[model samples]
Target: MAHIETPTDEEDITDPVEAKKVLRKVDWRIIPLLQFLYMLTFLDRVNIGNARLWNLERDLKMSGYDYNVVVLIFYVPYIILELPSNYFFNRIEPRKFMGVIVMGWGLTVTFSGFSTSFGGLLVGRIFIGIFEAGMFPGCMYLISGWYRRHELVTRMAFFFVANDIAGTISGLLGAGLGSLDGARGYSGWRWIFFIEGAVTCIAAVLAWFYVPPFPENSNFLTPAEKKWLLNRLKSDNKGMSHEKMTIRKVADSLKDWKVLTSGVLYLAVCTTAYAISVFQPTILRTFGWDDLKSNLLSAPPRLASGIVSVLIGIWSDRIQRRGVFCLGGFSLSMLGLFLIAFLKGSLRYMGIYFAAIGIYIVQPLCIAWCANQVTSSAKRGTITAFAGTLGQFGGIISALVFPSKDGPQYLPGIMTCVAFQIAGVIAAINLWVCLSYENRQREAGKRDHLRELSQEEQDQLGEKHPDFRYTV
Candidate 1:
């Protein structure tokens, strides 16, 4: 093992005021660009739901389960590519790599507008998935590198607020663009793809210029600020931040029980979220709302979800507890799903608000919770990507559950989401108990036997180091 030197106390930011200033500076520089990039990413991915309202299925001659297949195919490459993409993110300049991938997806989305057949659209979706695989997990990995563990959820909440905002924007844009039904001979659905995709390409150019490198190499930060930030992170992570990427580190992250459980937690939230993002318009239509009205109505639930997510993030970070918030959020989502499945009329529609808020809240909390447990940058990236890969299964499941045949109540799909939320609640409770127990054991010096190991071996222990405590 290669040992890295730890930052001295002299390099640490001891003054609370100065520390806050540095954090705020980092927040403004990185978070907004990440928010914009991710927002566009989400808008491009889920706008297809909106497009369905504008006759995409009819225009392309899609029938039966063809639309579902289009949704399902995107996740195949998406799930397969995430781990490798994160692996490459570690080895490449993040801005350059992210810029390239964003451009790739943007172009795919733009050209997808021109598709004349189901096969053409399917091919476009696959390419979009391939290009977009790295984005969310990559953002999570980058955010973890910049902020302390306790500060993480709030920042990630803001990041995911972009996701909710994108959901809102997708609905609004769909309504706005769908009205263009024919402009220069293109249908309103094509306009959605063309306009959004073009904007993404433009954003991609800006991303190449603005997205900051990791703290260690960030040019925007003064050397003193960099030193302080690095020292703070090193102390927070017990010097585990100094570890290099290695095969063993990767393998260790893959096998970690905590990482796997976190994935289950994430999966439950994502399953419901993905279902709503892709099918909310259709679901609303079943409630007797016209297509445009359905598109317009979808905005409020997502907007409400964004607000609740930010509030929960602030509260979770202040309390510095992850599991309790996750449990609350998951329970709220289950309640919403239950209402949506069982109720009728306006009551059923109101359930969407609860589901949206709950799912969005749990999504970021689970991501930050998972990232909080791992100390090594390499392992953090790998584990975040791994957990994220598992979560994408929700997208696949979402596609299958809400088939057109099941619409006008979609009881089976709604119930399926409810089941996953219950699973999420259980997973969250189990992880909390396990992590809290390990933390107590570490505090009691039960892991002190490892102190006799060589310096390199001790460093290699990463989160398992006796002095390291997990955030539950």
Candidate 2:
């Protein structure tokens, strides 16, 4: 039902400068607003991790294993509804559809503030996951509609930085709000959910008017500008087709191995990334710090994650490489995972937390890198959503694996993260090798159908036009 306007058969033409000129004609007003909305989307999901050490555990009377269980409840519906939600996202206007989703999850998050028992917490989180799952992939699809192929990495990087900024803001906000314990009798953890969720609700209300539906719908651009934008897209790949069904859309999508590969690597990244986000506060407590201090100190490592994620994303776009950056990121994370697995004393444990910070920087790079490799707009949307939705399974597993009893070192969780990092590295390498082989075949005039380009695409990429190169 989602209709993204792509170029029609009659509009297929080839002039690079004219295409670029056409792109300039479209409006730009809504871009900043959409980016901010997603930053809040990502931030709200992870802030529960920040609340772990504050008052969440005590209020729930969580046993040795309850922490991970709480997070696992979130992934159940989150995984099931991703593709369907995205398909609808394309059909409905983002201004309305994404606005509804944001508000739905914001209310769920706010309701969590009132939960007195773990059962109530699980119910709130499940709905949060269900609604929030619509955000990122829909945005990726939206971005593809706005920017051309060559311009994607930089734009994706800019959009992704909001996710990192949310992490930083979570820390800063956690520090200020954690001070609210016993203020008007509300606990520190409850305050976190209440305030952040309220902000999300307000942002959701605003998004209804702020997010542009498509080029044609954008009042910021003249009618001439909308046609120009449509033509630019036609040049890329026969433009948009919204008549596709969700099942057929997915079936067509599976023909590309990039989806499977990206999903696996993202799964691994999620493993290591969630380990840090979900457990870092608990890890901090292993040091000599008490509850408040542990919560306060946890902020720095996440802040460090924010700083490093932007630096790496910018560096990646500049260098235009994927495998090496992705591998290096997993390597840093693996080192951090192992350090915690093997070491023990408080000071030594603090050092392990720093390694955790360094590891998280790799995730956004891998996502941006993988996103660049996928071409078709609809296919790209499915893959991005699939990758993220599947990756959260790591969150589900960790909820059961790391208990309060495993605290102080959480050796098993550390080992699992390290092992998954190795898996992530292999997935990245495989992606590089497969794409490299295809790149070579195109050079040799032997473009086969085994994940190689079809003849129509071969012609477009044959010249290796400055506009056409693999995302890596």
**Top candidate when judged by lDDT against the true structure:** 1
**Per-residue lDDT of candidate 2, residues 1-472 (tens digit):** 4543444435543455545544544324545676788888877777787777577889888765566777878888888887787788867988899889999999998889999988888889889989988887788777766755545555665676575567657766776786797799988888999999999999998888778776546665545556667666556533233333366867767667787777788788777666666666677777777766665666666666666666666676677676777777777766766767777675456555555555556666666666666555567677777787778787776666677778677888778777777888888888888777766766665543423656565544322432334655
lDDT for each candidate structure: 0.89, 0.70
Q: Please write out the lDDT profile of model 1 over residues 1-472, one tens digit for every residue.
A: 4543433444666666767877899999999999999999899999999999998998999999999999999999999998888888888898999999999999999999999999999999999999999998899889989988999999999999988899898999999998999889989999999999999999999889888888989998767778888888888887466445676777877888887887898789889999999999999999988998999999999999999899999999999999999998988888888888888889999899989998999999998998899888988888788878988999999999999898788999998899889999998888899999999998888999999999988987888899988888
Candidate 1 Cα RMSD (Å) = 4.7
| TM-score, structure 2 vs. true | 0.84
- What's the distance in Å from true for residue 434, model 1? 0.8
Taking all chains together, each candidate's TM-score versus the true structure is: 0.96, 0.84
